[model samples]
Target: MLATFNSSWFKLLGIFTLNQTEVKAFPMRWFGFGFNAFGQICVHEELIKGVWSDAVNEVKVSTPTELDNQVDTSDCCLTTGYQIRASWSRRASLHLDGFVSNESCGKPMKESRGCKDAIVSESYLTLAFSDRLESWDLQKKEQTPSWSMKLKPHSSGPPVNLPLVPGGYIAMKPPLYRLLSPHLRAKSLALSAEHAILLTASGAVYTWGLGSHGQLGHGGLTSEEEPRAVEALWGMPMSCIATGGWHTVCVSDGGDLYVWGWNNSGQLGLPSQGLRKTLLQQSSQLAGAPCQDASTTPTEEPEEEKHEEVFISIQAFPALLDVTPSCEIRTVSCGCRHTAAVTTTGDLYTWGWGDYGQLGHQTFISSDEPQRVEFFREQQMRVVDVVCGAWNTFAAGVKEEVA
Candidate 1:
């Protein structure tokens, strides 16, 4: 028998699909794009559609591809799976037949734990049961957890996994000690490689943790062990926030977007010399022209022009990012070196490391500014939310339900 990626047991809040393919109209709620070198996105050998040609050392997926899970229940001696989980490097689906398929390596193993939800983190599996969360070292023969945390009956959610990092996560509904805001209450939280950002119910934004890359949004790059309010956005009311490897992006209540931290590859949506130079080399190669090393050929900008340009390598504090005044941003998500945002009008915009087509633009060209993913618009699908993996993106769209 064959099984598909159904959003049943693993019901992440903002994932689903709506398909009108006139064939198997499964809701295309969950769509993936970008790097699939390890098959984390496709969970298979390779995708036939929307896949770009890869170099000798890479597999760049340039378009949004939906998740398809086909299981040979009888053939593999496996039972029907109930849920699936994904990390930066692997995909694991739990089966009711006492087995788990480690899709990352195309191997199925025997298991017999009825977990309600499972999250694939950088190194281990975060299993959520009805009353507790367990951290299991499935790589080891022992199924027992290195440690475990009992959940409160009223706990808000599972520990949110931080992208592109080791042993990094935010156990939300956290202890008062981690949250320095005594009078304010947190409504949202996001973690990066080495820092954390928080949004308060009163519209205040706070950050803490490692700030070597200025991801903390402070005027200087100083790590903060305690939460510090971002004075740069003192009065602005932010609605949402997200973090990448070493950058942060947030949306204001007014629909404006703000970014900070490392812009090494324009992950902050700011001009990046390195990214520009790389794009130029790619363009030159595509045009059959000899590519010049940036070291050998200095930038063509006149000295006077260079002097006048800000040439921001890093924006240490929160900086307003202008996508468009009319495009009111509702939410945003950051990957290892890219960013994606959903507009209020059901539009999606992406930028930064497009080397893997995380931008969903049908090309493997990276950008230093925002660009619309026209594929979804062309299909008349309305984007509601987006989630970014280390080098890929997952988005969910909504459509009028079929009767």
Candidate 2:
């Protein structure tokens, strides 16, 4: 019986002309990266059609015009010469994945060598589409390498797994190599992540790859291949970083607030329906099923603002959070769908969709905005650390001692 099965399989394989012409696609190289025709940065590995397969790295198509191209006129870019400078000692294979914009549209023009001085920061996996990929010597002088290869004609590759130093080569997959080259588009760029922190030039935070729930700060959502920014609070530069399942939160310089992604049970300090139904299944599970239907309404006067059902999942755009703008947020932490934020006054607030008291709220409730959690109210805890989990929230702070 076993031999018959094997023989039958071999015969089927032979019908497709097992011995045909030699096929050579992307040779198994290490890695590659370059600008695409639309000016987005592209990356790839050592395989044929490797970047495109969802099973492999998440490589996708993005038009150059669909990105932000405005140069951040902030002191950071101006002071650094709009060029990324590299510390020779910090030469690591960096992969930066995100988005970039410029003032001009369509095609790129040559800028002065000094323009790249502003880019002299940390290591990254992939970068903005139009950013120039070059090397820096000990003296910080940019060294141009001579190599010829196709770029992403219209595609790019995974944004993580890059070494944090130099002397590494990036392998570019098809279509991507042909589309995105500094020779094609101007100041546009894109980014990706491999379970790491991705800091943008404009004080924004983007995270992707994996981490059950707390790792993405996207609530209790499963996972995402593309990148997303923490949108609750803007104009804050994050320093340290940490991640967990289904959620990811960061701390800012002066302490502000920002979050997005999942909100199953208000874990993100945002409201959401904890109910989950698979693509083929539908279930009506509710925490507080409001009992006000058409029958309950009195034959229609000016109807009150109808509350819409919230389905917490990965968000395409970052949602700005509602927090006391007057209170300076000192730190933030994310869990599966719950989040905690410490104010400068030593006060802590939490929200998002949580089923396991992850919000520290004592009970499950979908909080669409920031809410003060009683767990930290009694203690004048000075939060120093925060970590989020798939369905758990944890924080470490110094308890205020009675003087």
Candidate 3:
């Protein structure tokens, strides 16, 4: 065999070994770019020392800043309101600007699963998982609920009561066990200012809470007491979903993106002029339609009715969006009014309200259509994830290896 080694075989083996080594050595480096209105970017002090004269209006970063040192693990939430860092060893730390109490900072985790989900608002922060939830009030500087509830898991027998804390009963309604319903077992959830969206294990999406802006995707601006399926998205399996302050977004398994709700900020990616024109045309058509009463004189059949038109200030139905001509969207996230999407090919696109430079375009201009963030492409970086805060955007990328 030593005398019969093929040159092509050796070359292939060398290539394979190199590829394996690269894969093993690949390190994930995080970067926080775009808006840093509230120190949410979390950049090193040394790097941004001379960049800003006033803290309120920070400089816009077109290039990525390394954050691996500050963020111990990839499981972290960098929101415009607050930041939560979960270490690799399963310790969690909550950070807020002069809001969190001394006792709650760097608190240890009680659940073995660590912090599975974390959400921050202007006044509070909440971390929840399958078994437990903890909340901290920013104004009061104290942990909320002030009590715990006794509950039994689905596998256990009948429920039993346990001693309660000082704040009376917390009134656990729609009991936690109800979530185990065969048809409504939620796999993930996203919360906005007042709305909540839940994605079931079966690829179905259900939304509840505030529907005033049609963020619920129920084809009506009516709030629901219970979770209701997004009727328009029925049968179209969704893999991921995100909620903005007043908008909702979801991505299908086939890479299709659907958006609904508020359009005042152009977050839905629909042209304002076109939408206004459509609304006017719809009003004209409705005004011209013959009275449905049989007693009224018959008129020409409304120009033969070519197609059905739907209009709503709040898009109560999910509207399919074509961000790019050919790119397939893999994931999407929404800020207060802005939206960001990552394509299957590691391309990042952003649109919607950008008054704070959240769109990553190096300017404070807002866009209606999806615009690719050129920084990543210019640096030959591959964006793997994107997160949007109330007024900022954070992206995680890895350097692509050239073949």
Candidate 4:
């Protein structure tokens, strides 16, 4: 299924992974963790029960917290996994599977013959059907659906007044902002707090916008007006790419993870000043500290004498990270100051700023290297996909039942 969207934050949420024998919906679950001062990642009860207080924003979810939102199933059926349409322009669409009916004619992904795509801006909502694209001016409509839910048998009349949620279908139109008009043949695009990264159909990646934090991956801290190829990543074909507040991470077709840009919060999965300080504190308390592993865990003897304080504040070029010795990466996502990835073996790994437990390691401690989340593993579940919010991480997976 060919997927396309206009927002820089758009990523296919796997809306069509159904069993061949059944065209109906399948059961899916969502697990979220990290900062929730705004209750954006809170479960239904957590959002409704907790009252705003000075210490509320200080609360952080340090582990995989099962997120539950009451989605109305009266008008539609949720056949499969949930979706979180993260978009920079605030425009997004949740993909689902319905059927051919009168209500689906104007649905964003309603039973189209060709590739389906959407463009949502402040003034208009344009949809690309099989043979043609249509636009509807929002200013002309009296009452517009809260982000139109896209899929076959589309349900389009839900009034959405809250923020993004999972477990149901929703089409989120951008509140308003400048639109991204990519001149390149880009297949996937991701937007950071400042920089922009785009992956072409050929698997080559290009970056532009703010580079002050090396988020541009241009080997220097210089901004760009037009898209420029990242020389360090040349010759390698990447399958996925993502951007964070000031960092970038992309997985090659071979499953190797490459990261660049800022490391202040260890977002690059490389040793950062903060992590080093934590390590030093641990070493002072313990006899020996292991720093040989790529995760920078306390496993091997420290090599600090052999090398100066080997902490990276900024990685000007792409750095290969061996997150797991034998496993390959299938997908990756970045938060404002954290990063998360799903391995080929169905394990989810996370690193970086964990002040609010976005790392999902059951702790608030931050790491300078990738650490596999044990929640899913302990539950005998295989994580298939992951997405990052500004301060939280969500992983979608299925239980791996013992035979």
Best by TM-score: 1
Error of 2 at 294 (Å): 11
TM-score of each: 0.74, 0.39, 0.65, 0.68
Deviation from truth (RMSD, Å), model 2? 21.3
Error of 2 at 266 (Å): 2.8
Q: Compared with the true structure, what per-residue lDDT tens digits does model 1 show for residues 76-187?
A: 6643323333345554555544345553333343222434444454545555545555654434445466556665554554332221111233332222113244354666
In angstroms, the error of model 2 at 216 is 8.4
What would the per-residue lDDT of candidate 3 be over residues 1-403, giving only the tens digit for each residue? 1112222211110000012233335543445555553344445678778865676656455445654223222334322122222111111223321122111122122221233334344443344433554443323423243223332353553211111111211112212122324457566666665777878778999888889988998887889867888878989989989889899999999999999998866788876543444445555577996334432233665756544433334677999999998989998988888899999999999988776777887666677778998988887889877777666676767688999
Rank candidates by lDDT, best first. 1, 4, 3, 2
lDDT, candidate 4, 76-132, per-residue tens: 553333354332222122434422111112123333223244434334444443333
Name the regions of candidate 2 deviating beyond 4 angstroms: 1-196, 200-236, 240-254, 273-314, 364-366, 401-403
Better of 3 and 4 by TM-score: 4
| Model 2, span 1-403: residue lDDT tens | 1121221111110000000121111111111111122212222233325334663222222111111223444322321111111111111111111212122221121222222111221221122222344322112222232222322322363321221112222322211221212222112121212243455435566555664544455544445565565454446666534333344445566554445444554545554444322211221124343333322333555558554455555543344455776787776654434566767776667666543344555453445567665544465545443433334343444455569
Give the worst 10-residue stretch by lDDT in candidate 2: 11-20
TM-score preference between candidates 1 and 2, better one: 1
> How are the candidates ranked when ordered by TM-score, highest leading?
1, 4, 3, 2
Winner of 1 and 3 under lDDT? 1
Q: Model 2 — TM-score against the truth?
A: 0.39
